[model samples]
Target: MKPRLAETPVLLGWAEAPLSPWSRFGDDEWLLDIRTAGRRADQNRISWAVELPEGAVISRTAWRGLHQAAKQFLWSMTTNPPTGRQRLSPSSVHNKSSALKTMIRWMALDGLETFSSIDAGAVERLRAWLLVRPGYKAKSITANTVVNYMIVLKDLYRQRAKLDDAPLADPLPHETTYEAAGLTPATRGSIPFIPDAIAISLLNTALQWVEEHGQTIVRAETIRREAWALGLTRGARRQCSYHARKALRRANLIGPAGEALLGAYAVRHAANHLVEACYIVIAGFVGMRVSEILSMETGAVDYHPIGETGVAQAYLVARLFKTVDQHGGRVERWIAPEPVVKAVELLEQLSASLREASGRRELFLVKNTQYGEIVPVTQMHIGWRVNDFARHVGVPMHEGKPWAFSSHQFRKTFARFIARRDRSQLFGLAEHFKHASVAMTARGYVGSDFDLRQLIDHESRAETATALDRILLSDRLAGRMGERIVVGNARFRGRAGEQVRRDYIEFVLTETDLRIHACDYGWCVFQAETSRCGGEEGPSEAGRSPSVCLSCANLVIEPRHAPYWRDRRDRNSDLLSRANTMTAAVLTEAIEQCDTVLNRVGEHDEQV
Candidate 1:
């Protein structure tokens, strides 16, 4: 450098008659120097300017350094799990890097090189300088430009240089913090409206209508025949495979009897609607996710009834369809319900006539139609049919947008229903849903924290009510035992007639409530003992048994007090105690049902 000036260098003023850089290079080629100072009447801040150059030039060394750091930082950002790719993608990198570039241009306008060259004091000064520059009032350019600049500057300083004297090491510095543009919170997009319950009914109606139409009638029937066969054949894969093999060996395409039945039923039937009905019931009522129901084989369901016709039961076993890891593979689970059994039974009845018609049971719905021969009823086919059915039903349709009705929602709904009915049975619900943890299922699918808390609180209250009721019942029985009353069937009574005086009477009442108190006390005790003592972890042992009362003491009365002791140890006391326990169990069951219903309501509200 030819004797660089030590004093603050003066820059050319716009008042000093400047020529437009755009004259020669045109607007695109003219480097838009967004950095300028004191052009506006307001306070001092960064300003914009256009710098003219001689020829086609490589980037300055400092510029290259900034670009390289940005590229490296970008690469670093992208190097994360694929699941998080959107948040840390190359596109995000580009946005961040672009901001950095603007910042670097500002730095250049301030006559600085390699942001690392600026110490703590210089950074302070540069920030002060930025406040007064013109074009700094532009919000996007000001905020993001400054933020990206500081970030890249800090990162550069951290990696390339170590300076204990850096001003950034201080608690705080006054500078504009620029963040990426999209980082700010904005209004969320409106949730898409899909015709819900009514829409589904309409879709079903439409499918029935489409089946009645001339063009698709035969194809519709063929699909129904196949779907029915699928529904009818319920066993393990091996069983299905064996049956399928046998059917293939027979190879009867449209048997005469089947054709005759089809002709007879043709006017009244719509096969597509029947197939649609099968899916809707399977995917909806059974709570199987769409993929699970679609990929389900004939062997997945066990159609055999556990009991009489109305008291039916069936079990379904299949691998869960959607998983994080495809290779992890095959999560085997089962669901059993009477309603599910009934639905499967109906489907089997419908497909009964077609079993003899197909020898090559490639899949339940494969047909040699005009469209093609032996088409598998895949997920795509199901999705298409559902959409078409929706359209036919006069429900407005979108091409690829997901409808509110999906296979997954059904599963969620099922879990919600079970949770609503029996909250204490969360573990059981977890098992039914084949979830790894009750907490996971609850948190993931359940509603707002307030609602969940209320549900749990309701459950707790119900349980408390039940326990209190039991204690009350037990107290009544103990009090009755003192009277020595006997009756037919409920005749038995326990001992301790004379011993049960005023104090002992109080003692019996106390003992019945004592067990309930003991549990509450033990829970409190264990929590306190472990936390206060800071000793061994995990569950504490049960406390000792409570004192016995007139209801439970089993004390014998002598003949001397025979008049008072008559029939004191009769069966009534034991019967009353049993009754008390049963009442508690029933009350507990009712509470559980209340909990389940509340939880289900919560889930429904969340979806809404």
Candidate 2:
């Protein structure tokens, strides 16, 4: 008999599978084909590696015992559903198994190798160890990473009953995964919204490209394909000789009604740029994930009216693969603006030849560089395009360095643009966006596609900070709330209007728990308990309901907002002359409300 080391892994062969589900794999391997795993590219490679410390070989019994537990964890993923079991993908498998591997390897060093030896105290110790390594300085592990490690322990407890070397009791029974790992709202990270200048510039350039050069790019593509199909072209311009370029150029490639595309030598590269340009327009306007955008097929965009209003709204319909299992994630819709719809239509044309060639319906297909076969473009590809597009368009620098653009920034930025104004301007900031009709822009906010409220609140606070910064410098202000602010600022800010330092204002902004919600007409210095137009979450829920806010005490009408009120008074007075008796009463009341606002700021001709 041989002595067993406490550190050696053991008992591998206990995990087994039936022939029905095992038919796809060889006797020794369980390889997963990730082609249909809601991914456009192969993303992760999952495996387990176990051994004793200092290069010592793990004994056969010990290796199999740990392997048996690892295999049982893997088997739990393969179970058929309606059984409340989850099917794993390469990404999830990689995340879960990598956690398991790290835990076991670290455990061996501590002289505990078996699942039976891992207790609740051991699990808590493992979490603490993962978060703050013994030798490393505060190279803090992210909340997500720690939470992922805790999940491995929780799962081990879940299948303990089924495994031969399973733990005797639940190792994480008292603590939930997040609680044990110390993850909370303050800990989880979020990608920041794109800076305003960069976003507006990027979107404007993208829209211009789709509007002006879209048909030219599509025409160029059609000519290249027609030449290839007729055997006039051998391959790309570089692959073919100069003779091919001259020959294609001589064809005059009259598109539709005598319109011609670019010179033959430029066709291929222009088609590629055209796709990137469309990516910015669609992704910026709609706030879709890069993967979701790549999954789209032809005619995925449409303008449909919601109710009897019959005002058309643009939307992109695509399946979100983030929650993919054997049953995939739900279909997601985005309230796209007109620019998004235009970009989508242009993309359909630009991608038509390649889509037909590949026999795949995905709109974001590109030719594989090495193989010339079409495949879906990955996030890395778009990430490169984002920076390239920024450089190409000369997007302005932020704080001295060129602003780095990413696909993730658009979603956060879009959420802020909506939240900052309570979605009053939603997509209709005509000065910036050159938006469509008011009715159409108004419809951009109402859809099943948008549910980023928590993120919006976070960003809305940021927007409020900017607003307060500007307000603190202003000498003249109006409304009851504005009067209070003026009196409040006079104390520390000095009666001479000497500027208050921004850091001091920010300190007060945070310390007092101040919230400033801006609207199209004015600002609302919100105190949820006293709000008239719905409180707390009300502005977000009602899309800022400025009509109701018009009478609220929280309203602060600045000098900048007086023009809107003056215009309102004039328009209502004009309407009263043409109104019938019942309608006349409504117009008279509207005029009175506007007069009340205009008189306070001295904008009205007649003072009350």
Candidate 3:
């Protein structure tokens, strides 16, 4: 066998060649070297690459070789990635570094020392080990997580193949086959939306609390301490004239201090409630992600003129972590409602103390009394506060457990509210959510609630009832003097008018073929299976004209529709009066059509 070199070659000059002028390490590049004792610069300080064996096996020479190769691969990807590929973000690089370390540790455990020994069987065995391996908190590893490990391995081997370094023919299995071995497919989980009732209650309580307390809460400690001091002094007073007078003063001070302390305590309690309330209102109403909400600056909210109109439109601008371009930055703009604007103002006031102390303008900082320092609010902090608020306000049980709200739920709820009000607004909602496509918005944001079906049925019934009322009580029909009027098998008499109306409504509701639709002149009782109207074929057909419904057999008129036909007749009369010989004929025909509709409803001779 050829003797292995004592040291591995350094592929990239990490210290000499700075990735950029603004790199964290300065011009003293000689301070960093690959073979430095104690802690190597690449392994410890500036780089994510770890020292590994050089050869394909577990010998000392192989460890050194692998470590140097891995470091070069990582450095290349970070600064000068292959064409058509961008440099990895810091987070991505960190993830890859961690995954590679885990894979090396797994290889050491399996007694596999060399790169050549890592065949498809070794990779498969590593996959099985990862599947049953205990992860954080001793939970079994997830399928998605296993997939990530496989991807890192595949990338490592592909890089080795490019350099003709490793002896393996196929280092990793096909990605599809590797991923399919996992328990579940890799996909984003469904987003949870808070129940509408719970959302409303939360907002209402929050808004009410904010209104009751102007801005910041005054701590009770100052006033309460004063009151306690006075109480102690009053107790220490002796029973004498001099002491009695002093006791009187102490007692007087105690009463006022006690009242002030109580008031302060109330304000303090209100302040605690307002913190969560403000967050909920802003998150739920504004539809901003938790990260964006936390990233807001002191002056993020602003108002500007909308187009040429002098009317000012309020909006908020915040940093967006997701959906960035090639550059690692994205900004999102949100149109703010009045409630969101007020909530933001309240947050600014609440965070003022923290902002002043830390010299940081982040809108959601909280002062840590223990450390006497202000820190940026985190997801865990928000979660704890939300749960605290929910407990305080007695948030009702959800599925036999107390409702545990999260910040993401607020965003999903906001999307659902927009979709419920007007489905067409979903496209606009997608823009607000910063989603790439409407389909993504629909799948993730739009969800049906338990009461959705009931609500739909209720609205349908209300519309049908309105249509039935309009057709039953036409003034035109009432004007016709007859004991009974007959149409087909149905009969309507003066005494039995109410009964006939009831029967018609029930029939319309029960029969699927019968439909009540509003036409240009009045309502049309179109029966799909029995109607002879030519308009059913197309709108341009002869019976599809506005005047066709006036003379059609399926026409229905009532008092509710009288005003509309009257307006048309009067307009036509005015047009006929001003018409020339050519226009007079058309005007006259329109006038006749209006007259026929009025006469059918018994309103032909009632008025102009």
How do all models score by TM-score? 0.30, 0.67, 0.54
In model 2, the worst 10-residue window by lDDT is: 19-28
Number of the top-ranking candidate, with TM-score as the measure: 2
In the range 233-319, model 2's lDDT, one tens digit per residue, is 564555443443554576555332244543555666666767888998777766667767877888888677859877776678877
**In lDDT terms, which candidate is top?**
2
lDDT of 1 at 543: 17
- Model 2 accuracy (lDDT, Cα): 0.64
Ranking by TM-score: 2, 3, 1
Estimate the lDDT of model 1: 0.37
The Cα error of candidate 3 at residue 474, in Å, is: 34
lDDT tens per residue, model 1, 47-136: 223242233132466555544444433333433212333323222334455555565566566555554456666666655555454553
Mark the 10 consecutive residues where model 1 has the least summed lDDT. Answer: 516-525
Q: Count the backbone clashes (under 3 Å) in each candidate.
A: 32, 12, 24
Order by lDDT, highest first: 2, 3, 1
